[model samples]
Target chain A: MVTEGREQERISVLGIPSLGDRFAVFETMVKEHNISLVTPPVTKHTLSLGARYSPEFACLPFKGILGTFIECLEQGADTLFMVTSFNACRMGYYAKVQEQILRDLGYRFKFLRFHSSEKGLIGVLRAIKRFSNNASWPTVVSLFRLAVAKLRALDELEREVQKIRPVELEKGTADRLYREAIGAIDRATSFASLRQAMRGYFERLEQIPKDAEYAPLKVGIVGELYVVMEPFFNMNLEIELGKMGVEARRTRSTFFSEYTKWGTFLNALNDEKKELQKFAHPYLKRDVGGHGLESVGEKVRRAGDYDGIIHLAPFTCMPEVIAQNIMPFTKEGIPVLTIACDEQLGRAGMLTRVEAFVDLLERRRIGNILR
Target chain B: MRVGIPRALLYYQYYPMWRTFFEGLGAEVFVSSPTTKLMLASGCSRLIAETCLPVKVFCGHVLSLANGCDCVFIPSIHSVEQKVYSCPKFIGLPDMMRATVPECPPILDPDVDVNTGKRDFYQAIYKLGRPFTRSPLKVRKAAETAWQVHQTFQRRMLSGLTPPEAIEGMFPQSVEEPEGNGSHPIFTIGLIGHPYLLYDEYVSHRLVPQLREMGVKVLSPEMVERARLRASICELVERPYWACEDEVIGAGAYYLGRGEVDGVVSVVAFGCGPDSLMIEVLQRYAKRLGKPFMQLTLDEHTAETGLMTRLEAFLDMVRRGKRPQGISPPASWSQRGGSKRGSASWVYLA
Candidate 1:
């Protein structure tokens, strides 16, 4: 508070590579600390840059994040935030390797890392303190709450978009509204304004002219989180399916929802997750690391709801590879189409496969109707 | 009861303990035949194209055990160390086998995660023994003996014996020393990789035997003690999170830093997840130290002749020693510097 003349340091959290809008939350959080936030969207340049510097056979998400880091550094981001997991996947050591690569590239920056499993809320507070320019705890905590509220609202908007996209009368209508909703949500400066923005968008989304006679084919998407959530990595698969007049429902929740579910005692009381584990128990009895358990569980659990299941994964993703191998034997009698996404995946090839799968699903439905 | 074990993956590291335990429990143990071309082909046919070679080999071994025994033993090893996991493929091996490998016998999968306290660890052992005999006392005795044998195997490895030699010494009649024991080797090469890749002659293309024939002494990660490995791996900026990294990063760091071996060779399966990162870390470390390092990537298509050519070239470079210090010309070049060499240099420049 005493030094008003200190230069402003720009802060940037590790970008999700696809969901650039989520960085707005971090921007708001850093605002109280007098640090500017650098939020950059993933581009082709980012993918190529990350792939060049990353170790071959490292998963797709790692390359994307590494590319984003280089981009952030170039954009005058002096402080970078990243979270590492404790165990299970290769994700835990991502920060370590990325830090090494960044240092070797001769980038001058400060890295603030947190173990996703360790220290819990206190760890987050301490990490914020490192780059927060000595902002008071109460202000930081309030701003953090506001950011979490915005994140939850943003996730809700994403889910709402998915529901309306398939049945909309005009294509791209829902996507355009989503972009507009995001801008309005980002402009909110308080929790009440955030709530107002969310509610208004929810009403506007429901009012969009949707096809009343269209009964869309439902497909459950399950795989590694980064590929499932990141549109660029999966080639905007959800939107593509929606454009084809098929509804894409993601079996896995976003990161914040996952935290709320497992990070708290609600994990024990969540019957939906319990049912998933129960159904998956026969096939995958233990966690195979990453989303392998969830992938299997969601397939079995949603066999009745989803007309088909698309197992999207990165090539050589250890857990998902195991899941894909075991999926056929789940014996849920549901048709499964596994698409392993890698840097080499082509949009034309992916669309052809997806089109064939949808055709099969439609034929199966007709066969059932005749019977 | 006849229990079969696939001679793959952790089998090279823990076969002694498993064999001793099965015998003590009054069950005849049948280990699958060593890795062969036919076995690997059958395994690859069942799995997707992207699985690492080691897992594919493991599947092949499991398929071989289908008709021989009443039940097959496949352990779901979550983690050997606290908070450090085995590769996902290993943790989910039993599930994969059940789904893909047709006509496989009933599997007895005992979970082993040392992080789950002593009681849970013993419970897993008891689960393994219950199918053999009803008495808990027999199971306890078998577990105790198995632990001792595993410890002995580890100690022998640390005392300058390779895994194959140490395993052979466990059989009382074959306490013979390794061949060419007294002869001093011209070059000692540090071979770093997983036990399965290092000891599986088919996968490794008989690397150890070939090295021995070439008057080279081979040292593997198993020959290093656990405490020494722990100390050596601290050189890394971040301690590796994989349970089996001691075989790759730890051994590579030790050999490169201490100059204990003249050259370091890391053998990695082509699509292996853990080895991908571990190899990068070691390769960069070796480069920083200006050490002679070679990476031999193994896959289904790895040809023996190609591997041999690379091995010979790397060894030849090691024998030549470090590059001549400065840009000094050779004696012949200096003598002809006035005419022939100057013309050749001009042509090269052009």
Candidate 2:
């Protein structure tokens, strides 16, 4: 340990994986530390880069993140961060495998990963200490609080966008506003500015001229996290559904809420997971890894609120495959459509399937009134 | 009462114990027939197209046993060792069966997780025995007997017998062991994969038998000593917490590093969650060691001729003693690996 002082005495240029629009929050948090964040927008080339080197059967998220890492490294990043889990999910091994792959590709980068749930507060603090470059505990704590607040505000804005999108009087107004709101949120660095942006966006989203008499069909989206969150991966399913005048709600909590639920020491026992397993008891008796239990449980829990359920997953995703297989047995008395996406998935085919599913739900709703 | 067990998945690994436990409870154990094209086809018809091949085969076996027994035992094995988890599909196997195979008899599904704690593990075992006996003593005795049989089976496997060869006590005598072509020498090749994939003659397309006929000696993961396997696993920068880590990563690393085997061949079912990652790990190790590595992915659509052709080519390479030269791994990391002394030293703390 004492002999490698030369190797250990380098500046750390940190790279964080891209997932949705959460890059804004990651940037704000890491900016205060000595580590500089590499924010790479996931492009078509990124997906191709990831898929080329990644194992043929790994999930899309792995491919996407690996591509992002490669991009970051190309942009002069020396350290990369990833979140791992200790469950039966393949996410746990992502860092290890990706590290090996990157190493074999001749990159000399530092890889850091932790099971966010198992690590708890102390683990997070230790991890922060490593990347923060000796920042005081109080400063780190405040920065962490800001990151949490920013994440919550972003999720709130997203939820509002989903609601106003379907019933907006003008076509495409809601989506246009959403793109602008995301940019505003990303630029707001201070707490006061972030709060102002959140309030202003919420007001703008709410005032999107709505048709008073329109009753949009409501659907719940559930499945693998990456596929559900990344619009490009799912081919903008929410925006497409909104264009078709259907309201889509995400049943899976955002990653921020997920962190609060599982990353804290208090929630280490996984009461939420146990509760989901309970709701899924009659169909799925245990946690099937990933969001599978929640997929089944949310359907059972909120079957009455939505006209239908849409299950989206990356191809060959284990837990989501289990969820898709078990969704039928739940027999929640609602139409359920399972769409498995991969690089080979065609946007046209996906849209046709969604259209047919929405049509079926519409007919069912009208038929119920006739009865 | 008759209890049905599928001759697929964990059945190859735990048939002895399961048979003993059911028979000790005074019930006749009925095992479904080995995998066949027809059974796999029927199973495939009922499942999502993306399910791994083994689970689909298990589903087929369950369908075949629909009318043959009073109840079918499908244990959801979550974790066998502490801090290690089985495949997600395995944990949800019972639920998959419940949803897909409606015609099947009542399922006696037990949740098995020794990682959770010994008490809960025993409770699950006892619950599986409850319908047959009310006395707790009978359940404990049956459980003890099952454990003894399982350990003996593991010992037999460790003694270098494949599961089928050990269980039946009959090795397939090669009609003629082909001489390694002309100037090439016979080689010892390490075969690593899940027991279900490796031992199933139909799924594997008689890989072990074919390798034996080629005059090549085969070393499977089961044949490796437990201590050596554990030690080899520690060599990994981070130990895989997968329940079957020993079968793939540990065995592959041992063979690659120890130079006991000429080359390592891994058989992974297409779309397997853990194998997809572990195979990559093995490939990297093989690259680092300059050992020839071939990954054969089996699926429902796998052709027998293609498998045989690949096997013959791989064996030929091993016979000639050609090192597979591919992409070089990170030089800095490998140099660092040499200096890192212990298992705990490689956690990559920055």
Candidate 3:
């Protein structure tokens, strides 16, 4: 525990981009608790610092978290609060691994995880209380209320994008609206206020025009759903593809993909277990981790409705790798363009692939279908 | 109308078994012209989003026979192990095929475990065969005899003869050796995937050595031939309906378990409906056993460089150990083998 008389000093909370979402919560929470918040830069160095020090098979999130922890520790953030979940994916225990990895780096920051105490309202306050030691109840309550509001707003606004973005008259307009809605969510103090702010953001967002013409090429986004739906995960490929003038069609929505892909996570039903097939690619073969996004992608292709396919998955994800191999068989005649990204991805490079893929699709469209 | 068996996958495992039942029922059988491009394309096109590419391709081949035959003999996978069977996708395949393909009568095996055994598979065939003739008893007898011959022949093949020659004495059989062509370094590729993915080379486009063009030889469990692979079986119970997937993976496990393969690589369908349950165990074996390995996922959009680059990198890691600090490891590897530090052999793909 920190010394009781450690000046009640102002400790700044620092984070990398993945934690950028938590910045507003941190700003308000730290203030109420007489602390400060600092967000670090999203840089190649941030990634290298992580890539240089993580397990080879660890997902990109691990790398990003490592960078955040390092940046914060170096910047004198004495205490770090990690928010994680009981996800069906292995990432749920990421905090434990990250904590171990960070400690090995010899940083003396106090790691306060949300789960070590209560998982809900009462638990969060207790962890904060124990961590801060000097914080009062009222301050905790206010911080809790603000954090809850921000988290809800973030989830609500992101979900709302799926509803509006796909149906919007403009191609990229809903995405822009999503950004604005997120900002409104970040600043929101209450549920009612967040809803009001979100409505206004959406209204204003709808005013922008998204000119998505069929453009002779319909590019279907395939592979693991995590990278396809999550912008932060795949470096905003959908928007980039939209800008490249290609209608990027993805298979699963975030809600269903994340929730259902890991349906048998606990194996509670005592499902049929078989001998593990040793594939050339363990990372690519298992469909259990992610929603059968690879299967979903293949099914979409076999339906034979698209021009080309774009597969996006995290670096070491197995199901996506397996799907990537069998895809050639699924779409025997169609041109397929696959891309995988991690936190280390450069925006320009990813865009280059999307651009090239679109170019190929367009050439095929005009050269064969149109003629 | 006759059903065509591809003589692949289940046929190898259950042909004598399935044939006795089909022939006893007086069903004329025709298998595909081996997994050629046309049948593969036909099978590939017939698959929907819910199935794996190999299964999808199997459907394509099944559909190829559907037009000329009375029914496509793709069974409803109700149970693989008495009751707690194979993957749910396999169980629902006949339904999926029935829904996806309209003009075909999907010959199904509802449940093939104990009480509802191989006879159940034939029951469906008998039901279909009833449209042509009467007498399920005659069908049963024929199925049993045909199965006896098929099993006897299967035993011969497992005794280390070619698949064709082993059955030659049983019927007017024609056996031919697969093209082993040249004496290339038997580049050990760990065909680590579900049975369907490994054996159904039509779907796993990476099965052969296109990657080997860059100097790699392919090694897979299926390529090892079941006869020579008996030593790979870690555990056994005399069970006819052995999870074909288990056996296939057992074949790969045997390959890696043998410890002779230079570098092991795994290729799986992007969303393997079945391997989901199986991979956890395989990973424990691979990761814990410290096997030199790489895994590549196949789906509609897997990139050439990414696959080749990963393959090359795994081979490189096995070959060079690691780069000597200055030379950059291949950009494809997200985490470089940590500055030539790893004890295992995983080098730069480049």
Model 2 misplaced stretches (Cα beyond 4 Å) = A1-12, A187-190, A261-272, B170-185, B322-350
Query: Candidate 2 chain A: minimum summed lDDT over ten consecutive residues — where?
Result: A260-269
Candidate 1 global CA lDDT score: 0.80
- Reference-based lDDT, residue B175, model 3: 55
User: Taking chain A by itself, what TM-score does each prediction score?
Assistant: 0.90, 0.91, 0.63
Model 1: per-residue Cα lDDT over A1-371, one tens digit each:
53554333434333323354566555654655567776677778888999999988788888888898899888787777676775667777788888888888999887877666545566666655655665678876776577667777877888889888899989888899888877777778898988998898888888999999999999989998888877777788888999999999885354454444335522322555567779898898877878888889999988888899888888889899999888898878889999988788888999999999999998998898899
Docking quality band of candidate 1, CAPRI definitions: medium
lDDT of 3 by residue, A1-371 (tens): 55766554434453433433435434544554556665564456767787666654555655766776777777778777675442224344456556656766687776666652244345656755654445777866665565656665565555555444544555667776666665566566566776788678756765655444434355666655435644565676666665566555644233321211234322321121221112212222223334433444344433457777777766654445435544554424677666667765777788777788788877877787667
Chain B superposition TM-score per model: 0.89, 0.87, 0.68
Q: For each candidate, report its DockQ versus the true two-chain complex.
A: 0.65, 0.64, 0.03
Of the candidates numbered 1 and 3, which has the greater TM-score value?
1
State TM-scores per candidate. 0.92, 0.90, 0.47
Residue by residue across A1-371, what tens digits does model 2's lDDT show? Answer: 32466348433688887767776556645665556788687788888999999988888888998999999999999988888878898988899889989998999987877665647677777666666765678876766666667777777777888888888888788778777876776667778998998888778777888988999999999888888888888888999999999999986354454555434443533655676678889889888888888888888877788999998888888998898888887767678899888888888999999999999999999999999
lDDT of 3: 0.53
* Better candidate by TM-score, 1 or 2: 1
Ranking by TM-score: 1, 2, 3
Candidate 1 residue runs with Cα over 4 Å from true position: A1-20, A128-131, A261-273, B172-184, B322-350
